[model samples]
Target chain A: MRLKATNIEHFYGHEKILHGIDLEIEPSKITAIIGESGSGKTTLLAILSSLLKPTNGDVYYDDISENSIKDINAFRRKNIGFVFQFHYLIEYLTLKENIALGAFDEHNINTLMENLGIGHLANRYSNEVSGGERQRAAIARALVNKPSFVFADEPTGNLDTKNAVGVFELFKSFNDTTFVVATHDKKIIDYADVIIEMEDGVVKCISKKRV
Target chain B: MITPLKALRKNWFKTLLIFISMTVSISAIFLISAISSGVVGMYSTMLKTDGDIIVTQKGIADTFFSDINRSLEPKIINLAGVKELNSMIFGASPVDNLPIVAIYGVSANRLDNYKLISGIYPKNDEVLVGEKIYKMLNSPKKIKISKQEFKVSGVFKSKIGFEDGGVVMGLNDASKIFHKNASMMLISLEDIEAKDMVEKINNLSDDIEAKTTDNFIDNYNQFKIIKTSSDIISALAFLMGILGIISMMSMVVNDRKVEFGVMRSVGLSSTAIISRLIAEAIIISLFAYIAAIALSYIVLEVIQNIQKFQGYINGEITPQLAILVFVISIIMAIFGSLLPAIWASRIDPMSLILGGSK
Candidate 1:
């Protein structure tokens, strides 16, 4: 479950969004991507999540390059999980159904919800919860599938300082779980086992702590 | 496979819209079919007025206007396939200020051929009138014909359009009012299986034509005009329905652009998204089918009961037609949402995550 993006380059129409970038995400280790607004941090995350394809290079899940993979969707569904800033929960389903969405039969959504402090909200509708609670619920849903890799884009971007710290702590508990978090929050820097900084769509700094 | 029922519950509004459009389109098709069937019903009613073949003057524009030579009966009766032959006269005569009243002169022996709904067949100069014409006159049960003051003898009911507006009396009594040999002949074959009865009768005499009741009406220019017109109208309705589906589906797909994008980012393939949308569309169309059938049945029933149209105006709704509409709506919905779903799936996930479209 190691994710490697090799010399990745991407553009939107004529303007380049992500320039030649290379990075390696360690298996079962928490990695943090930090950058300013237009530094392509989210673009790199999109590539790792297999939601976008880099124009010049390819993503590697362990030894297999994305191009050699016959079914990228099946790969993503079985191994990758995504947690966006907005917590895109389907409005029509109750919290329990949404959390249980992509999980295998062995996955326990009720246990995940309880661990995330969202057990009582299982029967509630998406709109009935507060923003922080909803974010927690989203995290619970992502983990319920027990994906090998989890991608988080600005997970605490919309939260207050207290809730922001709480969310970062939630990610820290997954130290033995592979997680690539994209954020501009200064408060989450201490929780990272590895920190990668992006500037103008290229990697600027890579700092790691021996695990 | 995602359950369509689940999707419907999640996206109730979109589902309802698809259902409504399908219902309207299906009902339009059914309405058109009912009107066309009404024509056929009227034709069948006309056939029930006689047993097999009807005869008229060869050169006459209409059977009611023909002058068949009464002496021809002997020649026709002795023909190989002939069993029994009877004659009748029909014409449009003025009734006071009323524009025209249809008058029919029949031999007493021929009265038994028709099913009278009410009253008895008129004898001598007395006459029987159609229920429709009789009701239109607002006469109090009894009415006078030709000032001879005959009782309202009988009211006959027939599916044929001709019987809808006419009065019947003895041929001798009618001859006194208007000169006529015989207008038409109602003939039944001695052998019901005779295939060449019409052909044989046609060869028996000049200035005379014989045909089965169904073929005779089908040959009418009036029936042809109506048939052609219904086909054209049905075609137009079908086209409009397709266009309607396309337009509405475009709006629906456009409205759900962000939703589809979200689905794609959640590891759903473009094909999966397309399939889900199509499934939703089909479920919606099914709802509409049920609605349209109910609405159409109520509508046709009201028309039949209120108007009392004797023909097949009260049409039958078949399950095949419902299934046809359901499948057609699904196809139309898939085509409509196809391009939109593809566009949504092709969206760069980075752009969406960056809150660019917001």
Candidate 2:
């Protein structure tokens, strides 16, 4: 799905977080928003995924206005998926149940866990696993529905280099879905198809990878 | 389903306390109402003889304290709707070291077969001794009442505790021994209602009047206050159950806010998540209700089997009332968790996911 944003502006209370931001995302491509802490990368990703509404601009899905959709929750469940930075796996649920939350299909769970190399931790609760394992489980959850667009806010920020690379390689195998990642990690940015650098709530530069 | 259960397991002790309090509140209401109902029923039956209307002195509160003489009795028998009248003279005589022996002296008509539990009714200076009083005697066959020797012709039982330990004999023997007259008269009516006859009897004289079961109960001021107080206690016990369960569930919901937020992020709809929490609540309520029933039954049986309390009252909750009380408990849990569950569903994944608020 192609997403085009025109003049997106956001404010948290009286403080502006995103100022007149504009961007375009192509279908079936990995777009990375790179910035340091307090740089509005996560805020932009949240707005684009329809998890948050910007204060002053509109987001369109394939040029169809998002505001016209009656049930935004249904829309997100059907199209967009999210992976948070903290590996916020529900402490009460095992890795498997967390991933398959109303995904409408369970046949792919075993294969999906095996693909993420978290098959051993499928039945283990979040507390029983290491930090890297929890991060991988969060990614598995974002992809369980095979969503057309997957948004991640520092998906591998909590992982070591080897585990971070492993998580990045897992994203490379998704041929049908687009990956929109917000992170400051150099290793994750190396695999980006397009990198939008942000500084002080504004886009600073746009860099594309050479194939 | 398993998600909520696992979360609840983390706070099992608190949850168990909620269940315990729920059971306690329900059982308390049941026990209190049962005992009050039983006591009211016992007194009501003992005071309510086989008559549509009872005639007594106007100021008397209890039927046992009424002492309208035979002068008022003939006037009552000649009333328009009067079919038959039975006069009962009752007194408490301290006999055989038992300070309170309720004695009933019946007029010629002792035809109320329900009062006789075993053998023939008293005849020829004989008496029917109460089952409890007979048990207290060395020889159950005979007993001395009013300083006169009388054979214990039969044993009788009355659900009322006072009458269950009393004696019954002829009216002539009572007046001859105690030199006192009738205390109350049990009057039966034909076509007119007892209250109508009561109105006529009151118009006839100021010394005595007639009262149906309802009028007597209205004037039974002591028990009226007790009934009112017991009803409020019963209602408060029910309220305690509702509030306790709701608060417990609400607190549980508060503690699991982040977990619910995480679940919402995983694509579970608000309805799905709320239903899961409600399902967990129903399971808890069901277990607690079952435990309440079983424990109440055992405790009630134990109370009833005790020697002094054997015939008092059983605290068995009616199936309908039990189901209703348990349903209210579940509804309390539902209301308790509902708002919090909805709040959890609406939790911004931004705050919880990014640790932004922290």
Candidate 3:
């Protein structure tokens, strides 16, 4: 599925967040939005995923604008999955049930966990797992529904270098799902198929991987 | 959801506190109701006179201070609704300085208030004694009160509580000994409209208050004070429960704001989140209900077993009253938690993300 944002402008009480940003998310490819803290990468990612509405302009999923859809929540649930930087898991639920919250079908939780390499930690609560394991669990949740677009904001912000690399490699394996990640991590930026660099709410550069 | 259940389990102490409080409140209500019923039963038996109206000194509020002029007897007997009237000259006297002994003065041949078991009704110098008091007087045929020698005319037995502990004598003789005129008037009405008759009697004289026996407890100053004060205590207990629940739920919602945000981000709508919180509140209330019912039952059993008060009073909860208590408990649970639950639901899903509400 194609996610396109054209001239997306967002403001928080007159404080500009994203300024007239235009971007096309390639189908089934890993797209990374990289910027420093407060540079609007998370804001841009949120706009593309329909989690937040833009103050001006629009976002389209395969050519259907966000405002044009009658049921915005249904659209998001059916096609988009979100992963926050902090893992944001239900603390009382086992990692398995947390992943099942976004499962496309009932039987996909185990497969999703195994695909993310957190199968052994399935029965453990979110509080009982390590930071890296929690991120893997979050990744499993985002893809468990087989959503066309998975929006991840700073997915490895809480993980060590080793765990961060492991999470990216796991994202790389799901080649059929489009991943849109916002991060300031250079190691994560190096592995993306397309990179969007932003500074102070404006797009600084858009680079395509040569390989 | 299991998340809310786990949260309830985690705060078991709160649930127990509420349960104990509810149990105490409900048990008190049950106890008060039982005692009140028992007291009414006793009054019904003692006041079983054919008289429908009791006339007392204005604002005396107690029979001890009731004093009416003996001269009014002829006038009162002529009033409308006056089927037949009897007057009592009653006071407490001590035998050789013993504990208080109750004494009532009655006219000749009016045996409606007593059943003679031994001797006949007393003349001016003799007295009729209750069965229990006769035993206390060592079953003697004679006793002396305030140095006056009186023969025990008969031993009468009545199940009425206070009457069973007292003595009776001739009206003029009692008046002479007690140095009082008439104590009060007991008038039997020919009609059932007791209120209207009482009003007529009260209007005829300004020194007396006339009322039907049905309004006895309501007009009695001590009883009215007790009822009003008990009602206040009960109200306070319920208010404490409501406030306790509101504060506890508010804390819970405030602590879990971020968790609710995460739920919204995943797939839960605002309505779903509100439903979850309501479910949690209900679970807590269910635990409290079971605990309170058990505790209240135990309290009632303890009260009913007191050897002295046994068979005289019973403590229990009727089905309708029990239902009312349960309904109030559930409403307390729901009303206390609703505002907090709504607040939790209105939380912005974005604010629940990383660095949100920081």
Could you say which candidate leads in TM-score?
1
Q: What is the C-alpha lDDT profile of model 1 across B1-358, one tens digit per residue?
A: 3555765666567656656766777777776666565655555565445558888899666655788888888988898777778787876665433456667777778877657888777777567777666666664355555555556778876545446556677887776666777888888787665448888888878889888876777685556676687667766655665666566656665665555556555566777776766666666666666777789888877765552342225465566655665665566566655665566556555556866473
Docking quality band of candidate 1, CAPRI definitions: acceptable
TM-score of each: 0.82, 0.79, 0.69
User: What tens-digit string does per-residue lDDT give for candidate 3 at B180-296?
Assistant: 777777788786588888888888788988888767645667556655765666567566766777777777776777777766666666677777777877766666666666766
Better of 2 and 3 by DockQ: 2
Ranking by DockQ: 2, 1, 3
Clashing pairs in 2: none
Give the better candidate number (1 or 2) by lDDT.
2
Global lDDT scores for all candidate models: 0.73, 0.76, 0.76
Docking class of 3: acceptable
Query: Local error of candidate 3 at A6, Å?
Result: 4.7
- lDDT string for model 2 (A104-151, tens) is 798898899999889988899989998888988888888888888999
Q: In candidate 1 chain A, what residue range of length 10 has the lowest lDDT sum?
A: A98-107
lDDT of 3: 0.76
Which stretches of candidate 1 lie above 4 Å from their native place?
Answer: A104-107, B1-18, B52-74, B84-110, B123-126, B140-152, B157-187, B190-194, B205-228, B305-351, B356-358
Q: Is candidate 2 or candidate 3 better by TM-score?
A: 2
lDDT minimum window of 10 residues, candidate 3 chain B: B306-315
Model 2: docking quality category: medium
